[model samples]
Target: MIAPRFTAALACGLALAGPASAGTSLVIDAASGAVLSSENAAQPWHPASTTKMMTAYLALKAVREGRIGLETAIPASKLAASQPRVKVYIKAGQEVTLDNALRIMMVKSANDISYVIAEGVGGNVENFVAMMNAEAARLGMRDSHFTNPNGWHDPDQQVSARDLAILAMALMREFPDYSDYWNTGAVQLGKQLLLNTNGLVGRYPGVGGMKTGFVCASGFNVVATATRNGRTLIAVVLGALSGTERTVKAAQLLDDGFSKWGGGYTLASLPSQGGRAQSICGDVRRKGGGVALADDADSSGPIAAQAQDIGGNASDGGRFATAAAPTQFSSSVLTRLPSGKISLGPRAEMTPVPVAFGRTPGSASAPLAANVTGEADSRVARGNAPVIAPSAPVAAGLFGTQTGGLYADRGRTASGNGAIPGSTTAFAPADSASTQPGESSGPMRLQGAVRSGAAAPASLRAGAAAGIKPMPRPAARPLLVKPSPKAEPAKAGAASRKPAQAAAKPQAAKPQARPKTKPDDDA
Candidate 1:
């Protein structure tokens, strides 16, 4: 059952806020939660992928509360695997560690992994969404509701800029230890460089972390956090015309907040506005803006070479690769504030947090969704991961040892000593990275062989894997039977007149010898 407070809040919001606004923006003092600036901040609008910030917060809360562990295993259900693009594309039944799933969900803004996380935390998506609503009400998010894990479009799923600032602050205040998850600019997944969707990370000075969201209805949105001279600020911008616009707008708000100290209304005291964004899907310029929250993780060319570096193929590279310059170019937007400090440019490069599948190497508890074969304990004990295959499951001991790609430098055990054990399995080491303290750092013995950037070679490509599977050939169609035409009734005088005419008809000519070749053959 939904929380009564949440239900009441939803009813009140719907009754009072008739429609959302075209856009909303807010800036606040992170330490005090004091509102610095706001524009339509109380207007409800779609959250888009920025919804993942709340999801990340809940997962961290669960970990802190011991409801789940960082090493807990979560399986990607059919529902998760079937979610739309901007995902890691883990196949149904494939498992990921909670630590890695959160990193992927935050940095990559993966929709599918969000579902996997929802299941891991709340046992399923429905329960998790309920938890989200309850949490929102408890946090005093007066104009917010969540219907899905990844913030996919739903008319009912809405959040105000003020509420977004509140949520961002909650994540910071409650889980300061897990701050690395949101701030990291990228995470190397085997051969792929998964950069954060928020382009301000490495580019804008003092920009620490946060998340970005986008869809046609929501335009583009971001909840960004930054620190400078002992001052930290949270900026929320919603429903911009493009990705760059949203980033720039957030930067401008942050700059203004920094330039001018706060004397404005607090979040709770802000006036409530009734409206929603006018649908922008029909705008050709908005559609063609070509900015998306989802990055092309599988594209070849320069990104492929970068993946090779993360896979330990680059001469100057090591087990893990840091976030490098963006592969594509973006226009820089200058700040309009008096301080002239923060500006929106290309995504800044920084060292990424490492993530992998399976439990942390030395953890005591078994994965939440361990193998059904009752071999999870033995397999994890021996450092063997489940191998992913396109056709069918393979026998145990066939998957190779995980590489010392990017990982936390936990003291290596014999199995963790970067040596492959005696086995007939053919597997490649996955991506590795240096991790923040308390994150999963030991190398994973992932099941299935994944090349750089490619999760399951055949099953995890973004556009290719998320499409409808091929159908079996339809049965041969039955031949149609044409009914015989009914005989026409004879005219009154025809029966008598036909006998003489038929008798007098000239004899039919004799058939000539058939030609050797068919008549139409030459023609």
Candidate 2:
């Protein structure tokens, strides 16, 4: 099988990660299928980049069915190599086996790999996507539909965290052989050390395998799995702040869940919490971070493939207001019900945010998600990708009117110049002022927030016109005069920026040193 020299035949890369605009977050115990904790678990949302979870699910099904084997090699054709954004640097016509494809696709969350796998498996992405939908239907994911392989911006594609949890659980049981792929820490693909994006894989106790996702529409989301005392638990935390928050929240949830359930876990206990009466769906709706852009905006970070609560107050001081911020999201059975209606979780004085997800576009400058890792990433793990509904929302009997995989609250009102939530209030906008493309009317600018320090074209944030007070840019470092470029190191793999042969120009460019291979459909 054709395997990259750097990446072990085991697992591969990271994917985007972010949440919706509003404040939202959720946690669930996969084995029991319970909604342990949540903010707006039922609200419609943009599935962002988490859509890759579904893509991986479909591909894994093929792997398990013997249609494609781990050792089976497929080439990264020009078409696949041409995919934009996230990718593994595979040259055109360079053969990559099914196993390595999954590794790179999962760990790196390479869009290019997705395109190649789609074509190799179904002759084309359109056809492979058909298989994805078929599998979704078979899995009883009636509320879901897939429009792309990598979970980029496609309003038509979506999924809810609940449904995502279902898929995560299914993968755990249906394909035990592939489970090890998720737990991979990093792949030593030649000189490059491709690290796993999931923070807890090797850092946290009991954390096993899983995935994370993000995009422009969705926020940071992770299907976090952990095992403690022989009791395995998969905690899916959708739409968080940054990479660190996603894993930390998942770990906290697992800690709480294992502390209480360990051997006593059950489906009935899925809707666990710290101290509140959660609804059938969950507790407080799960959410990402909030950005104080120029306008009244919600979570404006990079939304993953599958991926809010909107909050704010503008009248506190002149036109300046504040927004609701996200809290530490975690999963655990209710410790003691707070004395209240429990419509929302208890509001303590934490970091207040205007939107649910991260800082709005003007302030949200980091990458919301990382790439996928392992032989197969999860489908629902696609991070936040903004979802703009059509004038006529798509409807069907199986999914119900106003029903889709995930949901976003498009009706939340906001105030101008809001800070973090708590003291914020909604106010009307000045009629003469118009919104800029990247800036929201909320306190934060909603136009250009992205994780990984990447960004959308400036054109996307052009709609808003008011000069948004941009987030404090990172401190500028004095540029030191660079030394003249030296001879490049010779050990880098095909993934490096410099040419592979430039560093170690072997006598005449030839494949004499190429590693021998035996098909590893089972790797």
- For each candidate, the alpha-carbon lDDT, in order, equals 0.51, 0.39
Candidate 1: worst-modelled 10 consecutive residues by lDDT: 303-312
Per-residue CA lDDT of model 2 for 1-523, tens digit only, reads 1123312211111001122343244454433333344443333344544566677666665543334444444556687777765555556765555545665566546677777777656657788788888766655454467887876656666665545665675555434335434544443333343444565543444455567665534455677766543344556665454444455455555555444322221222122111111121111122222321110011222211111221111111101112222332233211222331111121111111100111122222222111212233331223443332221111111112211121110111111101111111111121225432222132111111122233222221111111211111122111111122352322212222112112322221111221221111000
Cα-based lDDT at residue 42, candidate 1: 70
| Top model number, lDDT | 1
lDDT of 1 by residue, 168-219 (tens): 8556543443555666556545434566677666555666567888777777
The lDDT, on a scale of 0 to 1, for candidate 1 is 0.51
**Taking the candidates one at a time, how many backbone clashes does each contain?**
25, 178
